[model samples]
Target: MPSSTPLHTPFCDLLGCRYPILQAGMGGVARAELVVAVAGAGGFGCLGMVRESPDLIRQQVDQVRALTSNPFAVNLIPSATDPDLFRAELDECVRLRIPVLMFFWDVVADAVARAKDAGCLVIHQVGSVEHAKRAEAAGADMIIAQGVEAGGHVHGMVSSLVLLPQVVDAVSIPVVGSGGFASGRSLVAALALGAHGIHCGTAFLATKESFAHDVHKQKILSATECDTIHTDAFAINWPPHSNVRVLKTEVTESIESQPYGHLPDKIPRRVVAEEQGRPIYWMSTDSPLKSMTGDLEKLAMYAGQVTGQITQIEDVQTVIHRIVAEAEATLQQLSNRS
Candidate 1:
């Protein structure tokens, strides 16, 4: 990939953002700095709102607002509870009059109406064409096609390579492709397949502003696609069918040897140690450096299949700018010969 696409060629009218390169909203990893940095760099940044209390969401929103007057989105976890859990946060969005609201997981009708009532743009992330249609009917202004290659929770067997084009045709609204996008060539491929923009998580996890633990970042940098594995190890406490794309480690190996549907009586003690700020050979819930630990060899370094493409750590702004430039150049090269 080369730097050739105009810096602002792909603008997201749905969210009124300048760049089509979105910093994927990652829970526990997405922080104010990461959001602001990407937004400041001309791309839209999303703050992951899963597990956040209403007050925390409001505070994050206010913090992002103060940092940049630019339009940023709040990635809402619609699957967590009834819409009631997010009612207060929804009210705040209405109060602040935020421009973009991207919902992941379950999309409830009332949630859409509330955001719409506030004049907020609604974007929904889905894994299948069925979900895409549902989101659109629920009043989504856009749909994010999250393929199986995605890092955290993979929703469907549909991969980005196949799912993007399918959802694009299925929906009248904008279709954004996600799942393992780490380079401009990937973005170019996505656009050619009918995607309007790109949604990325793992790429942003390696950036300077990411709140991930230092060890986590290192693991990603060191890993290849084969080094990563998808497992339900975290699902014991997290979401069912909960899959995480993590660098293969002792924990994953141990978990994989167990019978299906079996859960550990207790989370590995390493999880607590990691959370308490101690280093461990395996990632546990307790790994405080979960976001950017740079120690993927022993941590739950969540990533996509594209983890193979990432080899270095870069500043958030540089990463954003480079992706856009490379995408443009690749597209232009194709256009020139054609």
Candidate 2:
């Protein structure tokens, strides 16, 4: 059944989910387990397939389908992915008849058109009102207006409190607020801002089903809202100039004192760890995953400013249900006001 009272919004109708909450497809953290749990719990789940090979995308897509018939999305980063690989990903997704493709970083018009042509609903996560308008112009079915305080690749500098409403007013499509949102209060705040939903990365990253390494999860649990630092120091593998908001580590402390510019993109990548036999490079945007082993600090420990609100770990279903119950209670309280 669908949600009610500020929990259900147009985003639910667009994605065919019971609630408008979306688990952001954070690379490495979002996998089949988390996606299935989220979808089964009546919220949207997206596979974090950023810059991955098409074969892996297919396998993960199949894995999610095997668990549930619910609608989910595969997230891809266009501006950061290799052109050839990006095209191949789109082709494979189209061939598989993927229900939705959630894109971030930039709104690639041609790629979005290709997905649309295949009858796939397109979602683009943007940082600014300009990009939101461009995504709308490009026929994106929904827009996740991400703020600078978000974990991982941050494209906009403004906080969601100011950015979400700006985006909601700028676009005709239903908008979802991203960055610094975790609890039911945050959902009510987003609704008040005219947003239809919330895209949560850090909150889901701490869930039991999340594929993040235990060490990384602990760090997030130990962090506060002020503990996250936004910087471009981890853009070695992807395109330069893209920024990420990660937990303050020994590395980020030094980077925070300097300018937020990218290291030379062509610099040699030092392998700091291995996950499922794949080399995890130093200064890469790859979040620590469960299969990862090595110097975990070398990789980005992505988290959002909402870390202050997250204290313990829970399963995906419990987190969603609690948030919904809280949102209902909050709505009732607000309704009783003068």
Candidate 3:
């Protein structure tokens, strides 16, 4: 898998992947299995280890290393993790010599510098151009301009159609577009938006290797573009004023739903589910992991607007292969017309 394809861009060399597709290191979904599958298939992946223990991080890194030599990333959210725990997780990645350290939420400048000092490439996902500039000033190697149409926890109000090119122009580093991207046509559109690569969450969440529950995958398959809702109903464990996009459900439409972007921390929280004995509180910043049990429909079902584009559950290899082939075809069509 060399960068000889028509879809290859400068970001391909930065990620050391054949295609300019990077699996979104979605917390609770993009685990070791999915990361390896994507990397082995010529796309880059990031392990979603946000708020995870140091021991678990080491175990996952070991698993990925044993399975594939392709460089992968470990995702961490400083805004969601405890200070001490964040330090420990950062230390673990640095100690393991992880190739890439991907971050979300408010950019932690010192953490970025430390990871870079440890010889790790730092990718900071930002929602606004000012923050993108801040990340670059903090020594981030790349930036992911996440639009409001993204799944899970959304960071910005603008759509990819508007925010992506602005962020690319605002920063000198390679910019990757996130949100509302799930197909080869979207990938070509991302390139047209001046993004060097595409970072996808909803697309990979439905893949066979994803850690998402079967119910979650099925919902995406059956959903449409209009089925996504962006609200702050699931902001228990994260920062206040957190905006998240999830599949529309009874929970979201119920009378108990919080006022948009305004959920009181004092709201009653019940343990609605568990993953490997870890409790998942209601309205927490987590979706149903594959290992989760109990009544999960009462919990969050994070999905992007792109969920509408997914119809079937494919393996990571097939997903990447199809996207690349389709992107190539799209490029040829444009060339023919010109």
Among these predicted structures, which one has the highest lDDT?
3
Clashes of 1: 26
lDDT per residue for candidate 2 within 1-338, as digits (tens), equals 46554577888888989988999989868999999999999899999998889999999999999999998899988888889999998899888888999998878899899999999999999999999999999999999999888988899999999999999999999999999888888898899999999999999999999999998889999999999888878877677787888899887766788637667565468999997888888887787888889999767899999988889999999999888888889898999994
Residue 33 lDDT (model 2) = 95
Q: Rank the candidates by TM-score, best first.
A: 3, 2, 1
**Worst 10-residue lDDT window, candidate 3:** 255-264
lDDT of 1 at 114: 85
Backbone clash tally for model 3? 0
Per-residue lDDT value at 153 in model 3 = 90
Q: Given candidate 3, what's the lDDT at residue 217?
A: 92
- Stretches of candidate 1 off by over 4 Å are 1-11, 81-84, 257-299
By lDDT, the candidates rank as 3, 2, 1
Clash totals for all candidate models: 26, 0, 0
Our model 1 lands, by Cα RMSD against the true structure, at 4.1
TM-score of each prediction: 0.87, 0.97, 0.97
Indicate the worst ten consecutive residues by lDDT in candidate 1. Answer: 1-10
lDDT of each: 0.74, 0.89, 0.90
Candidate 3 residue-wise lDDT, 177-286, digit = tens: 99988788889999998999899999899989999999899989999999988888787888888898999888888633554755647657789898888888887777
Candidate 3 or 1, higher TM-score: 3
User: Residue 337, candidate 2: how far off, in angstroms?
Assistant: 1.2
Candidate RMSDs in order: 4.1, 1.3, 1.3
TM-score between model 2 and native: 0.97
